[model samples]
Target: MTSTAIPSAPRRSTFAQPIMAGLVTALVGYTSSFAVVLTGLRAVGATDAQAASGLFALTIALAICAVGLAWFTKRPITTAWSTPGAALLAGAAAVNFGWNEAVGAFIMTGVLIAATGAIPWLGRTLAAIPVPLAQAMLAGVLLKLCLAPFVALSTIPLHVAPVIVVWLLFLRFSPRWAVPAAMAAALGIAGFSMGRADAAGVMGQLLPSLEFTAPAFSLAAFTAITLPLFVVTMASQNVPGVAVLASFNYETPWRASMLATGLGSSAAAFLGGHAINLAAISAALAAGDEAGEDRSRRWIAAVSSGGFYILLGLASAAITALATASPEGLLEAAAGLALLATLGSSASSALSDPSSRMSSLVAFLIAGSGLSFAGIGGAFWALVAGLTLRLLIERKRH
Candidate 1:
């Protein structure tokens, strides 16, 4: 009898490289977007405690979804609270609804998102949004945040310059680490500038706590906030997120992913979070070769990122405190640096198709205008204008 040697599985790197990749991915994602989340919460009348709880809830829910989905799908599917949705919430606050009503709106938005997965036509319609228009809307939504660094330089040059310098210098060698380095520098400068007593006060009570805001559904919320939030989350966040995965040739389980995001958002909304959806920029970090040389092992990067997210969620109080302790524009600067690549990519994608150029520009400009009408943000209107213009333009050609 001839003995045949069994094939061994590919050996994963025993070094901390994969873990580092995950850690960086998690840190970047959390730091880059957490500031916006906080601002949105505060805008919607959340007390500091409530805002902290929202961050904690969102992070934990997304962490669980990321870990579970990545493990099940064998793909790197990073989940996040919708950044644009948060921005919309911030703007929607102008309508002066109480936080409870906002939570109700969040619940409604999550239901709509979940319904898309359960309802075929709805999902197809959402999925069918023209890529250029969606990309344009996202670019518009990001423009404000991406301009933070410039704003910071103007407002707090002394603090921001060194951070920017560090980022630029590091970008030449370690592109991934540049943003994190800048963030660390910002935090360091902020801490020192704040004085020891203030810094200590900021670090007070480092524990995870849940704060529930009961839902108060209203027709106004449904039309003004919920619908727009759902649309932006779908078009600007989840759709682009899924596209990133597909671009890398990952056959994602779209239905399952959407269902998971909707459930996570619903659960987190009760605990003060707004929405949780697929991550676009950070997903690329975890799914690509940067995660690992071997595609099969990249899931570990996402799992590690999820674990770190949970830990960060547990320390939400400290995180919020630190963010609050920073100089007014410092967090924005750091976040802008983190989003620079994403904004550039989205802009390029939006204008790449010559046929969609005019319509895409219209969407981009409107969304970037930061206008709000009837509690709906520029993003929604931008989409509407873009679609209308595209229709009119294309009809003439035909």
Candidate 2:
């Protein structure tokens, strides 16, 4: 008899990791942007049911954008419900214009995104931004998730703290599977901590459901919402989105990606979703060795994510109900665990480069400080600070 050594299994990225990241990040994004989207929805006389439909629209659009972009680029490009864009639209459209105007503004931003992609000058200008600056922006965008685990710890000790410890240790050891593994562990603990998740509604609530909402458009809404949405989606989201792909050595066609983002945003807008843009943090997971280096094969992950998003969209009501039922700390812990790798990568992206070290440090500090001005997010401010510092340093060297 010939003895054969057992072969170790090669890994493919799991549904849980990406899904957890998606779900958790979406939760964060929604919380951040809902005020705006909600105000706009209510201003336009949207019912709670109609608002739910908007969420479904957002999820569906995100799924398609992520799938399409990832398929075209062989990078794990994800499309998200744009948090910053929502904030802009909220302030602009809340009372001044209705849904029609909001949709019109959405359409305009999409046009702008598309036009910029189509135009060589603008595309090239955006492309010319330093990779480090882009990475710093990426880091700034993810700052909230990084701190969430600890935040959960103070509130839900029986659940969040132990799981966080396990997650941190696993990350130090396993790196790739750490997040999913730790999260799995946490949910098990949550069952115990929550003291009757069955009674509290964990199992029954996982079932999916559907919702629908009709659309109405106006010019006033467009005027109020357009500028702000454009700024956040482009500056806070895509700038770093492209950079995250670059940081992982995946090639990104800046113009093509921007075009895709524009198209996706428009597509989502029609469905009542907020502006959709390339995902900054989670893309790292799907693009990494975890998702497989063979670009042809990588589409599987994106395709899977798209399918999952659609499913989430279909079951938007069910998802909302489930999330609403869960303990806030438990959700926070899961999100924190999922983001640990992305957070580490973002930190390293800024710190690893000697030439841009000081600039990146300044960028991280400014962004992580939670400063906001003129409705511009930390990512934009961080980039400005980094660029300014880099320019000054260069001048001194010269």
Candidate 3:
């Protein structure tokens, strides 16, 4: 009998690649964290500073996952806190009770997530779901975000249209430079507009200051914040996160990753933060070619991301200075453009599968529609739809 040969895995080049990726991921958080923080803070009625603290806490927690795993495995494993957690809280805060109650929801949700990690069934169940379906759902979930730049133009046509045009042209021509180039162009234009127009509340150098609010527990906040958040996270973020890891052929223990994230967020919540989880989207940046040429050292990039994020979390004031340093308009445009690729990729991939494609398509629509029930997010709705279709279709075939 002829012996079959097993393929040898590639060797990693250096730790520098993962280190740089980690740092860049942290650097992105410096400015971007404000968006999530503001939304979550307002949801719970925390002071702006408290919201910043929440973001700071989230960042610190994420760093812990990246660093902890790297130290243990000696392979850089990257992780991040939830960006969508802030988004989830924003709506939950607005519709639900007070901020203290929202914090209670945060704590409740984190505990549930941690518990979910401890159970082997959770991993098996989530794993049974098709990677393609999950990926598609994620892309669909972000469809609107991809279209945001263009749609945003209608709201402020005069100021933003030029950059949109330039960005569109660049995207049409260069393809690769589309996202970053659009980013630079948009920020440049927003800055120019802000300088000329001088929008008062949103402009000028804003200083970071400290403030505190006591947290109170409430069932309403917990239902709105905790339940919906966990579902969205499990479906939208972690499902796709695992898919991305699969794409890269980097296999870290899923249960271990979840446990780490849960513990990290559990600690972060006491200080004031929403949730922490593996880095799904940002991990792609470093784990992909953007981090470096050496493939095996991808974990190193994740480790780097964690360390730098911790530094940012520690120097909360410094993070604020740089973000508020730019014109708010610039921040908005820069953010929109910078995030476009992630949005587009998610939307595109969600539709990639042909079999049960409609099921996933329905999932995408439900999830991306931003419709909520019981304070749960669109991600849950999409998964529900996808699963429903999967079950019905399978049953009919039998």
Candidate 4:
């Protein structure tokens, strides 16, 4: 036997790890805050079908944006709907503008986002907005939603207790899955409680469908919805998303990312979607070490995540149906649980700097108060009050 030289075994492909990470990213991103999104859309006047359309549109839009950006830049650039923006909408004081005008506001927001990247001065102006105040506004916007779980506990103890218990258990054991687990429990309870008639109705409309609304603009919508939404999305999502990727040594193509998200948001808005931007929290799943050790191939994780998002988008109708059918406050409780961490982080950051403490507190209170005046929402007033207070304080110090 002529010294038989056996071929070495083939190296196992490493693609599976990153792909799995991408799947996790999509799952966590979708499950954690989707109730908030639906709630926000409904609050802003979207009908059930419309809200489902919005959710589906947002999921598909961001998924496409994430996949394209990752492939084009060869980087793990993920995208997400602005969870903070949704909270802002959910918390907004009742406005004069209806859903069409809100859609118009969404369009305007997208325009502003695009302009921020395309116009250097505009970007700087947005960047110049005090970080503490922005964070305060965010904390305020998140306050009510974060309190829902506690409020629900008092009202529906028997039904809500199990969901809260599940959340707490997972929170202590596997923190990352806590909110998602709570949402699953809430959905399970909701499904169990559904009468046969309700079940039949839901089964008939399980597939997602799109509903288009022609945009209508107004000063009230601009001031109350568009401006605040733009700031929240930019401040909370896009900027932090860039920072997260940077922490992983990945350089995001800023202008391109903004343009992509801006355009995507505008498109999704037509379908009643609020807004889409870069992924901040979920970006880590696709960009960080969890994706893989091969830095160069990490983009595949983002691409895979986009694929999963597309699949999730298909179930928007069913998810929305289940969420809407839940016992009053149950879904809100789940949404609140999802937002607690964010509320804590935002509150901590807003109060961190002593010099800005008073101003930040003012902003937080004003935003959380649900105040509306002359057709403008509390969010706009919160920023104004906070900035004015800051200016006065600075002038006094000087």
Candidate 5:
């Protein structure tokens, strides 16, 4: 008897899985922390329009960087706006300089990032910085923002409680989407607050427009903004981003990644974006098994995510308008909830090393204090103090 050969099951399209992964990566990354970016830009002397422009510029620039890097390297390399750096900006004290000076600081930060890749000694110097202290500084920078959720709940429970509850539900069942869900709920409240007369005007301006500001350098802005932004982006975002990719058995092209992000940051600076760097948390979405079983094809996810980011960038005006118009404490509460996980992780890492615990604590306290001296912000001082204390302690021990 002859047995008929069985036909194999039809193969699924190879592109669909990775494309969906890319879409989720872009959606989650953009929705999660954009409020924080807007708040950070506004904190550093940006007007509402300039803040919106900054957000748009950052989205487009980083999206391009991600697309280029992934396409050229054939790796799932992703770039993102510096979320930790943005937190540093949001927590920064009032500087004596204006928006122009802040723009100069941003340019300087981009130059420094590029230098880190081109100059071996500079990257080494940044690498030599103790991890615990760096994390402590980040934790300190995030403290006020992380506390905002409780502050909002205490003051505006009627408007804020529902958002918090939704965040909690998602956090328990779907942690990755928690912040985005809360942000959506917060936007709903903000939309309800807007009058119909203003809705048409807001709708008409949904497409974003860039606002350029020429750089005006100042020592105060450099000390308060540039130094902290560079250090934070490198330590918290870029370094961790590379490590994350490595964990998935992919080697990122370091110099290329840095140059791409640095140039992107510089190009976007004129339009108010503070900085862009390698993505840490969101990088996994595009680089991991979720993208596809074939490691060779995962780069498609990164490239696709970049396309989605461009689409999202077009909606910046609408997002900024809604967030800025939200009831007092509402959007801030969403931002705070978004940062809570980072704060916890940073705080934990800062205190994990027994030998450096005190120094790390010092850094954390100073950063959280909002102190300013000689027109310099607390973040700068926190690093100095932590390093000095660590050095002195090491000397005594020896």
Candidate 6:
């Protein structure tokens, strides 16, 4: 008589692979853009406590979205705060009503973004923004930050040279680590130049304090902060982010993803974070082969990254202190190095279509000009200028 054999269960995949990938992705994402966020917050008049709260809120929001979306969609749907929007804020002077107004504008922008996902026409209208015009506007917003490396070299050659050299070397060999390495080197230089005592003040409020500034909305805040921010976040950050996921053959639920980020952004804005959207640069880190050979399992990588981001949020006090401790030029230098590749790609895309050259150039120039009228920034004007030029050219041809 033969005995029946018992069936064995399948073994589960190890968590190490995806967890490592997630750790790397989280590191790259935060190191590359946190400085820019801090700079933007300061520029918009957020106080030390407020900035820390914003950072804390932004990190936690992104963590939740990244994990929740990846779990539900089974796609490596990584989320991020808007780097371009932060840079745009960094360029603009504080609004007349200050950070409270800015926070109100942030809330409004989040609502509009959420509406885009819920309302078909709004989403399509934003999607229909000319590719050249969007690229030009992003390039224009980045131009000033991209120039920081050169400025650093000229002004603080002794302190900045080492960071530049290390960045260049890594950029050639290990492109992924280049920006973080450079940022570390810059902070090191700054630490040596300015003692720990001076830097300690940034950590004065070590415990994360949620300073709730009741948002006061107005036309000026809407025009200056909300519109420009929403446009760039959608056009530059979210659009390319979708493309990145598609490159990996993930059919991302675009509307759902936008809804997730919009909700996250709205929550974060309550504490002073500018905006959070889909990540552009770090998306590949979590979605690509580097995350794992088995594409089906890569979603775990995003989930892991989200877990780490939550940890980072817990340490916001220390991180903000370090950012505040560093010299302004050091931060600028790091931001410039981080954005150099993006600026090049954006410029190329903006000028790629010959037929749209004039309009694209107009957009780029207006955005780069840093002109503000009636509290509206050059970014909005840039789009208007480009669209008007295109319309005029069409009329003349007809």
What's the residue-level lDDT of 348 in candidate 4? 96
**Superposed model 3: Cα runs more than 4 Å off:** 1-21, 28-47, 84-94, 128-145, 162-228, 235-250, 284-301, 314-339, 353-355, 370-386
Worst 10 residues of 5 by lDDT: 196-205
User: How would you encode candidate 6's per-residue C-alpha lDDT over 113-224 as one tens digit per residue?
Assistant: 8888899999989877888888898799889888988898888788778988999999999988998898778777776777768666644645666667788888888887
The whole-model C-alpha lDDT of candidate 5 against the native structure comes to 0.92
Q: Tens digit of lDDT per residue, candidate 2, span 1-398?
A: 99999998987655554444444443333332333343344334444455555667777777777777777666666667665454333223224445555555677778778877799787566556666665565565456645666887777676676777776787789755566566556546645545464435545545433343244555444433554356556766777777887887767776777787788777666656667777775566566555554544554565566766676466555434443344665654565445455557667866887877888888877766656565444545676788898888954774
| Superposed Cα deviation of residue 5, candidate 3 (Å) | 42
Superposition error at 120 for model 4 (Å): 1.0
For each candidate, what is the lDDT?
Answer: 0.82, 0.59, 0.63, 0.92, 0.92, 0.85
Please give, for residues 13-92, the per-residue lDDT of candidate 5 as tens digits: 59988899999999999999999998888888999899999999999999999999999999999889998888899887
Query: How does model 1 score by TM-score?
Result: 0.86
Least accurate 10 contiguous residues by lDDT in model 4: 389-398
Give a tens-digit lDDT track for model 3, residues 205-274.
2443334446677765665567656665776667667778778777766667778877777677766777
Residue pairs with clashing backbones, model 1: none
Model 2 residue runs over 4 Å out of place are 1-55, 66-112, 165-177, 181-257, 269-305, 374-377
Evaluate residue 337 in candidate 6 and report its C-alpha lDDT on the 0 to 100 scale: 81
Q: Each candidate's TM vs. the true structure?
A: 0.86, 0.60, 0.71, 0.97, 0.97, 0.93
Write one digit per residue (lDDT tens) for candidate 4, span 362-389.
Answer: 9999999988999898999999999999
Off by over 4 Å in 4: 1-13
In candidate 6, position 340 carries an lDDT of 87
- CA error at residue 260 for candidate 1, angstroms: 0.9
RMSD of each: 3.9, 8.2, 7.8, 1.6, 1.5, 2.9
Assess candidate 3 and give its lDDT.
Answer: 0.63
Candidate 1: residue 340 lDDT (0-100): 77
